[model samples]
Target chain A: MTIAVPTWRNQVSPVLDEAENFTVVEFKGGKQVKSVLINLAGKSQMERIRQLEAIGADVILCGAVSNYYYNLVSARNIKLIPWLRGNVSTVLDAFLSNGLEHKRFIMPGCRRRRRMCRRFGQINKRKE
Target chain B: MAKKRQSTELSDKPRLTNEEVSAILNSIADGVFTVDKDWRITSFNKAAEKITGVPENEAVGEYCCDVFRASICETECALHSTMETGKPVINKAIYIVNSDGEKVPISISTALLKDKDGNIIGGVETFRDLSMVEQLRKELHGKFVFEDIVSKNERMNRIFEILPLIAESDSPVLIEGESGTGKELIATAIHNLSQRRDGTFLRVNCGALPDNLLESELFGYKAGAFTDARKDKPGRFELAGKGTILLDEIGDISPALQVKLLRVLQDGTFEPLGGIKTLKSEARIIASTNRRLSEMVNEGKFRQDLYYRINVVKLEVPPLRERREDIPLLVEHFIGKFNRLKGKDISGIAADVARILINYDYPGNIRELENIIEHAFVLLSGGVISKEYLPDDILHRKSEVTTGAFSNVDDFQKRMILDALRRNNWNRTATAKDLGMHKTTLYRKIRNLGIELPARDGR
Candidate 1:
């Protein structure tokens, strides 16, 4: 399963629409296998989603996102886990260990501002 | 002893406390926010919370971009600019994505917050929502706006009125205009308003490429068709797929290619390069040219049949000088565009700059004015653009056109009248229309200017 996260300096990028770097990690047999950083620079709102779609990203972990981008990503059928924060390693470990339900992982200041996004780490496991 | 007493007297004055400052901030209508050097929000006022839909308590201590969600937050944040340049950005129009995920158009101004010791502690930004203003402007100027093309000129408005009818029809459209008079915009508008808007719209510049290259570009080649043909490729005709294709500068194509194009227009079918099977095209055709196709046909340089085929519907765009009224509107439009593009807070042109821009005949039309504004943006970091920021040619042209070139007003008028007469082949009515004057007024001007007539008269 390939999971993508828009990343900054050790943390999730502030907003997905304007985020520059996306880390696509491929997990194999409940362990890590491959990780690649893709640049999402200078892409339009629709083109950004198309880029993720082209990369075969199954689940997208990101921070706050505009409705325009949220709708487009949803239309593309990519599992979007938005409003996430913390150090990349911590978030990844929590995601791997299913520890994201812990309150510390929810993006600060946005606890009361959740949209139609799903609860953290409730992503359905896809068949390999 | 007297100096010490004066210092004591100064210190005794009443001072506003932190609560007073917060109260003052909250009382204002515009959204105001402050961020520390670490890019974390230090304060978010009541208006800021209202505009962003994020509570002040929820916004503070968070990274500003996460709360502000400005379109330029990641690329060229105004607060970042203020912190670096030591210059405030005043009234820069931008949009912020609110908590509800809605993009709210807002104009922001940023300044560096400094302590009493003159050390920069943080940056402050104030913004006002422009959605209502934008909506009102749109409603008030709906007639002058057609798609992205903004013009208050009468001729352009006439074209805008007929564009709906043109879009409804499936016939080939021919748009004739000066190079920068927005022929491509008119074509795109028709395509967007047409039934094929969901399909892709592609354009090919016939004058940009050589004949052989253009032929292959329009009609793709099969594998082994030529030296570079390694695989069968789909050309614009096939890729357009019932959409629309704009053939810009169609007058530039060679007569050989014209026949192939004529066949496509006649029966909507053509064979690809070195391909035996005939392929059909359902793409609607919209052709545009800077040159007159009829004149080219008269000279046998362009095909008569092809000209008639593509000229089923025609649009003629006036030059900048002919549509002189659009200059100020276009200047504002271009300034707003460049503010977002170049990430500057340029408000508008200075009064003298606007005067010069309005009077100068843009030989290159709207595109020239756009380039001029872009050039000004490079020289102007913020605030209104002045005369010095304009290009040298435009500066010189303004003086030459207005004063220096002609000995007197009569000489300039004579020169202009003579040129207009020659342009219309001495036809009084067409010359009058071209000059935006009455026919008799032009005739009287011709008589008073002592302009001589040639033997082969247009009359």
Candidate 2:
């Protein structure tokens, strides 16, 4: 599985829309593999998504994302694990160890609601 | 113990206890929080808990960004700057997402905390919940918002009224307007309102590329079609499956490309380059252009049949000058947008600047107004955008503002057309021919520019 984490210093970027760089990790057979960073600075929301599509990230571990981006990411069939924060290595380790669901990595207040774990800080997109 | 405390105090006012300080912090309306040098929350007041929907215990030890989630927390943190520079930030506008995932607009001020010995400690940030104020603004903005587009213009509202009706159908939509009049926005609105909302919305600028490139972009190219084509590449129509494809600047497409587009609209089938088999596209087509397609057709510069094909449902988005009342609202919208983008706390434009904006003729439409505000933001450090912060052309406008109307032409094309009209002895048809434009187009330009034509044709 391939995972893309929008990075800010060592922590996950707080805002997905404004994220400029991503640390893409390639995982295979549940073991450590390859890791690389890609910069998407000055790219629009759609352009960023297009870059992700080209890269083929199986899952995206990210912080807060707006409804505009969340719906688009959901439509693209990419498993989005939003509201995750903390040191990149620690979060990656937690995800690898299957401890990602623990509240330690979840963003503040996301643990309050079950659905918020899926999409926190996003307005529910109107389906009409 | 109270009598003993009174005896200990030498000053006129008695010293308040820690509990009293806590009580004072809890009593006020604005939320207050102090963060240590490590960026961890050291103290979160009761008001902070109430505003954020996070309890004091939950937020006190957490990182400020995680607890606060302000729009600028990660990037342009006010507290971070205050801690670094020792300069306080006052009344910076921002929004934070609360525990319920609702965005709460707030104004925050940050200051450096100090110890009794003057030792540097942490940073204190006080935030005022602006929901009530935002609600007042929303009351003015809400009724006019249609989908993502905001407008109160009667004609635009009429378009907003019939958009759902238009979106429900599978007919090709033609959105005609001046550049920056938001033609593409209208297209997106139509697509989003349609049943194809879930499907990918692809936009291809028909005018931006060569005919061959545009053709390949619109129709999938088969392997071996070109030397670089190692494998078949699906085009926008193929990728837009069950979705909507917006062909922007359709008026600028070549005649040959226009035939292919017409074929797609008519038969919903097209063969890719170097492919014998035909493919069907179920994608809905919405075309937008700054040029007048009707005039293009009359001038024989555009395909008449293609014009009829895409003009099934026409929407003409008026320019900014036509919808002058929307300037203030759009100004507010752009101000809020730029504040978030630039991480500054500009309140709004000055009253005189607002007057200048309202009365000015925006030839470049809404986009020009937005750029003007964005340019002003680049110069302003904080506070409201005033006249001095505006662009030079806007500040030093030619001609006197005697009646709040410009006597001189603002658009360069207006001056060129006037010179052409004079050179052609004021014969409009001859002038249009000389300018390589249709007479009606020239006539419309004259009317739009407020050019007072002489009664005598001078033919």
Candidate 3:
């Protein structure tokens, strides 16, 4: 699966740079997955999402996402991993080791009821 | 038989046509809804459908509460009360939850719908969407007040009041103050509150650019004006048309450019570089200076004409020492601001620290005070700010009492004598007696010290 990361100024992709701690990694079938990375250097979030979707990214990793934007991206079948705060390499290592399995990524302003709904859907239906 | 037939026909006649009533109700942009005496929904129009998101088909046969779920009832509902009293209710703003569970603001009016017999049958309410008014009210509340400025001094307050008034007029304004006195803040407040508020507010730091670059930035540049001028670009003046442009650090501009600026101010026109067409200038100009421009004019460093043109209205901001009373207040304000920014919960400064702050003459003024507060907050421990947190300059300044800078031995002696006398309640005879000197000489010394003697013996 191809993963996309949005950065404002700093380069945080750990496969390209080893020293940075807050990096993003992709995996498929329990093996390290080589992915296509898209740089949204100076564009706004909406514009970045449009660019990423145009390049056919399956998952997006970013520091934070707004509620409206989360809904828009989720509606487009793109998986969103948010609140990934750390150095590039450490975050990438954690993702590669399956340590990010229990991390909860909630959009800003998403109601508690909606989170509960998502939790129930994941538990009973195995809906990813 | 004919009379019976005519009576039956009249009895079977239809009421007002549905098409006519629907057209009338639908033509009104305001939401129109009617409820019977028992508060059952009798009619709902297309506008009501659009406003409440409940179609007429769903609303016609249900009670108002069942259809709209409004918390409004006979005693609480303004519409119901007006209908019961046969009076009309004027515009009233009310918040209601729409079908999508979004709170919508609405201005509504209600009246009693009566029959030909003058008896109240039902109530009709007409309401308009109030989202625009709500948005404008929010915008108005979001306006930058004088408190938005960080300074607590009287000089800044005076500027805040004068800036809005100056913004109303079309004349040029010159703001003179020390560096970092928030000259830019004053200019922005003027533009944001002015009649040209909707227009752009452009700034060009006169000291930041060279003469050629500054000229090109102020006056537009046409294609082929210079090596980098591959395309035409409108300068700040034209872009700030019908708006305001702040010429920051205007004192540093060269004399030649000063002449050009003076011509633009006088004629309200300037030509772009490498272009023959002279564009009509309509921007209001506000210039700031930290240097003494009038002195520069005297020394031939600045043009007299340009100085006078920009100085149409001069505002001089006093330095912070002149407003010492505002220092403690400013310190607290800055502490609060930085505490939130730095995520430190420093409650306040200690009394001794406050005293030192009050006594010190801040040469850098408000900006200096802000820096000191920020520094103190950074080093503060256990949420208490003490003198130890202060910079070395503040703590190391020599005390006046310990400096010993008096003119002569006599001056020191007089000061000591007067201090002793005042401490002893000005009893000169007793003071002389204490110091083993004659009362007359002590009196002479007191007189020489300029000490006022109280009237005695009614002489």
Which of the two, 1 or 3, has more lDDT? 1
Of 1 and 2, the candidate ranking higher by lDDT: 1
Model 1, range B227-305, lDDT digits (tens) per residue? 9899999889999999999999999999999999999999999999999999999999999999999999999999999
TM-score of chain A of 3: 0.52
Q: Each prediction's DockQ?
A: 0.06, 0.06, 0.01
Please provide, for model 2 over B165-193, each residue's C-alpha lDDT reduced to its tens digit, 9 standing for 90 to 100: 78889899999999999887788778877
**Counted clashes in each candidate structure:** 0, 0, 7
Error of 2 at B393 (Å): 1.8
Interface RMSD of each: 25.0, 21.8, 31.7
Model 3 steric clash total: 7
> What TM-score results for chain B when candidate 3 is compared with the true chain B?
0.55
- TM-score: the better of candidates 2 and 3: 2
List ranges where model 2 is wrong by over 4 Å. A1-128, B1-145, B398-459
Q: Ten residues in a row with the worst lDDT in model 3 chain A?
A: A114-123
